[model samples]
Target: MSLGGKVWITWTRKTKSNYVGKIILAAALTALCILMLKQSPSFNSRSPFSNHEPGVTHVLVTGGAGYIGSHAALRLLKDSHRVTVVDNLSRGNMGAVKVLQELFPEPGRLQFIYADLGNAKAVNKIFAENAFDAVMHFAAVAYVGESTLDPLKYYHNITSNTLVVLEAMAAHGVKTLIYSSTCATYGEPEKMPITEETPQLPINPYGKAKKMAEDIILDFHKNSNMAIMILRLFHPHVSFFHYFSLSVKTQMARLGEAPRPELREHGRISGACFDAARGIIPGLKVRGVDYKTPDGTCIRDYIDVTDLVDAHVKALEKAMPGKVGIYNVGTGRDQSRSLLRHVRRLTGVNIKVDFLPRRPGDYAEVFSDPSKILLELNWTAQYTDLQKSLGIAWRWQKLHRNGYGTSVTIADS
Candidate 1:
């Protein structure tokens, strides 16, 4: 699943003969996109944090066993917040949850509940059982191509399930919500530097369902004082492992983005690359190669998992009542060819590449201007260098060749 924030598409330039017409058409499209964006009401409330004691806050993390959610849970636990993770384990790996438990080991520091978000009764039951201060909603099926193949699954899982969670939040008086959104919501916007106000013209069912969920939240926000922060993230690359458990007084690979084998086909490209290197798969398949980008391959803004978790923590801290903020999270943009080169170099494998035609629901170039998240959330991606980011993930891959199948060992920081 290509998890990301809001993205912008770089329009290809036409020949000199049609340059004037192209400019006029581009202006019209831009105006239309902005007009469409205005359909949703704006949120001007800021710094809405209420007066509270500086102590542990109970947080309910939906899909906490998944990639980004697991990382966010680790961060929250490290910050001394009581966390309750609810995941059905359909797409989430229990190993990630076990890792969190092993790292914390405290009774109340972490709890895992096997429940699906689609079951409203179970969702309400979970909320009734726990007293949650905030909710990190990260449970969703996020494969762009798969969403195209199974539109109903995307709607039911991403759209309807989000509604169920929001309803439960409203019923339980859980005010603060940190929503994990993707850049795919922007689709092929005819604009550069996508902002919160950019038109959300999603092209695929995954993006459409997510956009619908955002709309529902906005509608609810209009009537109530629910503090909401929707983070539209760009492509999150590489598995982030390596953390120091202060309680243990040592550093270890306690938590990381370890997707299960079944989901790898629909998971991050980095996982597939590592699998190919480890001889688990044949070779890397370059999906699209005729894109309009410099390398004729799609370009995306890849955010490191560590940096992605940091953005969520900052948003959770800044969430306040009656205020809503939407920000784009990304580091910078890199083409597919460049990423493959890095994987090959870092893994020291001559990864075979099979150039294929364009993939469905895929855009040519997708990146974002993360200035809003930087200014509002005070968050900026630290792992900006692709080589450095991939290098870190590759090291983790080397250690966990079977991905949580082997016993984790303690290592010096």
Candidate 2:
């Protein structure tokens, strides 16, 4: 063969090899870009569960086994959303989750995990495993007196743990968050019917910790495409009917039958009063009867638990990405004696009231001007009739003397 022929053949082979390498590199780069786009919250069009049909949002209910958290979970389940409840059971009750399981017997509709938000690894694992569309954060150490005594626990559980949840959400592209905040963030308001514009001058560690969590959530929203809803709930009472129904349903559930239809309204104080009437507790200790109010007792705005839970559902559905919504959840009425009198009427017992000195950090008057939630979310307190609300509570307490069919004493207030 000729030398020119050999050189031409070798050059052709080298050029073809280089061309193949370039094509492979280009393909790799394109695949990398597509993967990045799929993971990015701004670019991603569908949830992690792309196979699922549209409009079926999967929600993570943190502290789902607690009082308010359980109620939120139940509502979410009823709304046909897949709910995953995470709780450490530190303050939450598994019995509540059991009741919820009885209430929502449908498989795959509700899930419960014995986990804590403070554990970043556990939180991240849950987020990684599930495609959550939003998060309703209700887990926190919220006892006012306990918070004052153990401020560190409050700070860790409320503030630090919230940061962990936010971090996980940001990393995993979960953009919507409905935080269970409190009117305690307002402290002792200067006037009546505290508006959303009311200054947040928290007087206790519990409120301070929650306010800190809110600040962090806002900061996260500022940096990400996060949609945040802060529902500052006033005193949300559970109705006797709620406890009665739950107790009855729980018993019926054991017999392989469906739970009863849910009734609106739930009570908080009526539980304690019923306990007193039934002689479970000696009597009700009226806290702070000299707070400079009309009845000399500290006044509070109490909304039914069902109403409060419904507000969360509305907030979850209406929350917009990159926008923040803050609303007060309450009935917009202040009552002290009226609440006690109604309790007496419901229980049909002369409830003995022991007037005690005001507890520390107790607010003088704190109700809500919930007009914003009403107008914006179209949410209203349906059970505004206090007597009817208490009556429902009385019946429940009378039936479930042990509370939720468990030996564990549920928090009455």
Which structure among the candidates has the greatest TM-score? 1
| Candidate 1, run of 10 with poorest lDDT | 44-53
Quote the positional error of residue 26 for candidate 1 in Å.
87
The list of candidate 1 runs beyond 4 A from truth reads 1-54, 245-252, 408-413
- lDDT of every model, 2 decimals: 0.82, 0.78
TM-score of each: 0.83, 0.80
Evaluated with lDDT, which candidate comes out highest? Answer: 1
| Candidate 2, superposed: residue stretches over 4 Å from native | 1-53, 240-268, 406-413
Question: In model 2, what are the clashing residue pairs, if there are any?
Answer: 237-266, 238-266, 238-267, 238-268, 239-266, 239-267, 240-392, 240-393, 241-392, 289-296
lDDT of 1: 0.82
